[model samples]
Target chain A: MDFTYDDEQEALRDAVRGLVGKAYHDYEQRRQAVKEDPGFSEQQWARLAEMGVLGLPFAEEDGGVGAGPTEIGIVCQELGRTIAPEPFLASVVLAGGLVSAAGTPEQRAEVLGALAAGERLLAFAHDEPGRRWGASAEQVTASADGDSWSLTGVKEPVPHGARADLLVVSAALPEGGTGLFLVQPDADGVTREGYATYDGGRAAKVAFDGAAATPLGEAGLDVTASIATVQDITRVMAGNQALGAMQTLLKATTDYLKTRKQFGVTLNTFQALNFRAADMYTSLELTHSLVAWATMVIAAGDPDEVAEAAARASLQVSRGGRHVGQEAIQLHGGIAMTAEYSVGMFVAHLTALDHLLGDGNHQVRVLSTKVADYDALDPLDV
Target chain B: MIEGRELTKEQIVEAQQTLNAAGLAVPHWPEEYGGRGWTDLQRHIWLEELQRAGVPTPLAFNASMIGPVIAHFGTEEQKKEFLPKTANLDIWWSQGFSEPDAGSDLASLRTTAVKDGDDWVVNGQKAWTTLGQFGDWIFTLVRTDPDVKKQAGISMLLIDMTSPGLEVRPVQLIDGSYEVNEVWFDDVRVPADNLVGELNGGWTIAKFLLGNERVGVAPVGSTKRILARAKDLAKETSDGEGGTLLDDPLVRARIVELENELLALELTALRVVAHSADGEPHPASSVLKLKGTELQQAVSELMVDLAGPASVASGAGDASDLAEWARISTPTYLNLRKASIYGGSNEIQRQIISRTILGL
Candidate 1:
């Protein structure tokens, strides 16, 4: 029932805030970092690894810190506050998560150990071209030759795919269901084309033409369920991150209103503009509550409830992000429309996060199918 | 008692007394004053469960509004006289705050209570005294000093509704219900001892009571119940095709969106309750009232849409072939419009957020 962070959680938050805040406090620093090839600061990423944040979710036996989702969510929120151009969500929470969920002990130690040590980058190459977000892989098919498997398909918009050392790809199996595989980015028959995203982040169009791949865990096991669960978890974490960004945008809007003047008075003196800021605050607070609850639901470890909670939180974050983002630009007038300003970039990053797993419409569609399954949604019971 | 308006005064009192007997009617109050001394979360769960069970809550005037103000600011004699009776529903209290010219701007109310030796002669009118027809007493804010600030010149006086020179005239609402009244006082005398707090200090008590009103004003539990019922009704409804209304993507999407919003609100309420044990309402409590009422009205609107043409039969009787839910849908929807209007209008809530929270 408690929503406030614990003393230890607060300490973790302060630590991460200190690190990212120092690096991205000035908007120019984030803009300069995103201009580079990797789209983020390598030193800061290494510092996060040194802080054990990159390994916060994996088991210690798998060469990680073994922290719960709340702690991981804290780091995500901190990164979101500054709109840090890091691949933490793409690399650690998504790709590293897939390995921890579907990979064997040996593979987990190898992939996640290197990832946690900041020696390797992994990207989950699950999203393919001409397909809506789903757990099954239709275009990407896997062929098994004796004990080895090779993948043949195109996985476009593979987040951080070019910078990744290993690709955790999902492919349709010969029998049924989706199978998880690990492919080397420079493996034979693999093509990687990377470009900057609208949010000043990086993603790549990865093509696999009979690229040699290793099974994540068992050779022919169906990891479709695992893929869906990990995606759900990532969706919730993305919500946490968006909550942070919305918080900053709201503050920025309010701070601007109190100082920015037009026709001889500050913007706050205008009820019309101030009320919109109030609504943005409403959106941010609601999103914060939903994200916090969803994170706790994950920490509560109820697999059956995770998907629904994730979709609910994602819908709220999506709507809230758009409301706050657009209002921020509208309230600030012309300045927020500029590329150099951090507010618009924050909005762009929120849009990227919304489309990453599923946007508001997609989530509502998913939820609409089961609208009659329950009489009412009880947050506590979940 | 569906919607609670159909219940007689005796039935309402009996139900509340039954709850009071179990210490469930006023669990939010202090332990010495017939309260269970439950935490805010516990009281919240109690409310949600009561709503889900379709039990009519203790009268808001007695349980949520005036009862709390009395317990917080009343003298020992006043507390000893009214606290038990209020909790047990022995005294049906009505709120006499709003006037014709002072709805949102309540501090501008002209109701005056002049000191007349041991009695206060009260005059002026109070509008929108909901359920005043059943009131045994009324808690009022009246001007005791006309020279100072509009807010500062006010004082609270407890007046017996049966007193001479007092009249209650029912005001018909658009819903065709007699749920509210305009109370007039022409030199009605209230005992000087009936004053709940100090003279010219009613504004502070009014604010305190209003804040408490906002805390539970969301009605999250009952709104959830009605929405759940609406879904069942939608399933039984026709969409002009060979399928039920629930089969329509538009209807389903609408319900899904509302359900998601409700879940967010419920979670927000939980967060506020978790932090509100310190006695000061959480700043985010304003969101509860603003968003809560919007969702409540939205759910009611969904029902009328589900009923479609049948919603026009709001006047249908028991013998009518129209579905019971369909016949009542439009009126229920109309009645719920008051939700956003009361407990401080949604616009006032936005003002609070912009000024108090966002500091805009």
Candidate 2:
């Protein structure tokens, strides 16, 4: 009911923003400079890990912050705003969450400490090359020969898969079901062809080819709940990031409009451009509230509510993401279309968030199916 | 075309019992007077859930326009006499503000009432009275003074629809529906106690009621249903080209644009509803009504366009390429032609925004 962010969450977000603020100025330039190896600075990663951010969602026994999704959302959103070339989303958020959710004590001892101490990075090697983004895992295998098991398939487009120290891979079983297996990145027969992801986070076309792997977590496990949790967290954090970048873009555009004179008047003084800015500003305002609501829904831990809220949040964000980026470029005129301008950077981040997981269309389809169910159940004409 | 209209007697009874059961029948009434004693959000949720459920739009006469006006501005005996029946729908009410001459400029209404005795005998015609033929009563504005400017002299009254010499006749429209009527009060007798608020202050009550009628009139769910139908028609209709009518670049663009607006309007409505507890008549109603009406009209137009030659085919909406699909769209479009005009024209909304929001 209380839609406003609390003091603790706000201060935590401000701290992350401060750190990222100092680290990035020309995000596009930094994005262009980064190669396929390490995405963000190791020193920065160490600073974040040392600040107890990477450990924010883990239990006290796991050498972590013991905070909830709100704190993680802070870091995720801040990183997204800068479009910081980093594995934070991959290592700190997704992989870290999965491991914390299902990993054994021995596994947590090895991975969580390395992650909390900034010694290791992990990737959730779940999404495949051709499937629509869902929890139907078809990436690897788990063959338990009495005592030992190993994985035997490819996990492509694994975010930072080449550089991640650990991989939590989801695989369909030979018998009938799905289980998440943990694999060390340097395992034998694990061949990863690396590439620089467009958003500047590293990804790879990985070929497992019967790689040696360690079995993790219990069997007959439903990762559906966990995967949805991850996606919702990802979505809200992505929205937060988009919020920051959009606000920055808005501020920059507002400033530009005030000073950039045309036809003997400033750009904003013109009705056509003014109306466009007003519309973008309206979208941003709505997206801001919807994202906040999504955070509340995710924090509440109801899957259907999370999906509906996230779908709605994505709908608003999808529109805002495109509108703000495009209008920023449109308002900035030719300089915006050029790579040299900040507007293009916002455009890059926006486009990335737009298509990430599945765009507005995918979420809307999910939402509409449920909405139809709701219609059928209640038969409310509305 | 719309087939026919029928008085929803069962619907009226159901709405009353349901509201009473939910304890939502009373809001502004005192607890001693049977009010819900609920918060603003609770009141809003009640309204929203009812609308979303499509039980029936709460009779504006009983719930919004008259009952609250009476509760706020009526005397105790007046309250004791009217509030209970209004709540129970013992007396169905109709609005008697709009005239044959005045629509949005309600204050300029030429209907005049002169004081004669312990009662006021009224002589005036009220046009576009929705369900007026079925109404048991009405609340009207009559010009009480002539020298004063247009808005100053109007007085509000509760006039019996069945009063002697009152005439109610239907105005058959192009949509083939008789939901509205022109009510003529031929020297009708109404008690002096029927006067609400002060003598010549009906303008305030009319404004209040108009504001009440418009708060969330966007009808998002119904529009969602309509747009869904349009999407189907667009996909189905053949444009006599290599593809369907949907493949027409302009048609697709329009659909996308309208859908985007619907999304925007929805978010806007959510924000308004979310913060609706702040004790204000939200300024965004101007935005919502503006966008909602425009989008509703656009959807109707899109339906007609997608129906194409079937829109004017040999058997439009009858055993043709369109079937019953075109019937709903045609009447719906004709009926929606008033959306922009009724809840204050979208142009009026723009003026409101220009003055209030934009500071123009």
Clashing pairs in 1: none
Task: For each candidate, report its DockQ versus the true two-chain complex.
Answer: 0.86, 0.10
Report the Cα RMSD per candidate. Answer: 1.3, 7.0
Model 1 misplaced stretches (Cα beyond 4 Å): B2-5
lDDT of 1 by residue, B1-360 (tens): 544236778888988999999878999899899887788778877887888888988898999988889999999999999999999999999999999999999999999989889999999999999999999999999999999989999999999999999999999999898999999999999999998888899999998988776456778888888888888878887777888999999999999999888888988888888788567878888899999999999998998888889989978788898888888888888998998888789898899999999887
Best candidate, TM-score: 1
Query: Per-residue lDDT of B1-360 in model 2, one digit per residue for the tens?
Result: 012123376676577757766767666455665676555445555665665454565576787778878877889998899888887777888888789899877777887788888888888889999888779888889988888987889999888877897899999877777888999888888889889999988888777767655445676655655675566666766778778766665665566555545755665666665565544655554567777788888888887777665556423533554556654556667887988987677666656654455432
**CAPRI accuracy category, model 1:** high
- Which lDDT tens digits does candidate 2 get at residues A224-299? 6677767767777777777777877866776787789888987756666655655555566667666766776677
Interface RMSD of 2: 6.3
- Give candidate 1's error at residue B129 in angstroms: 0.6
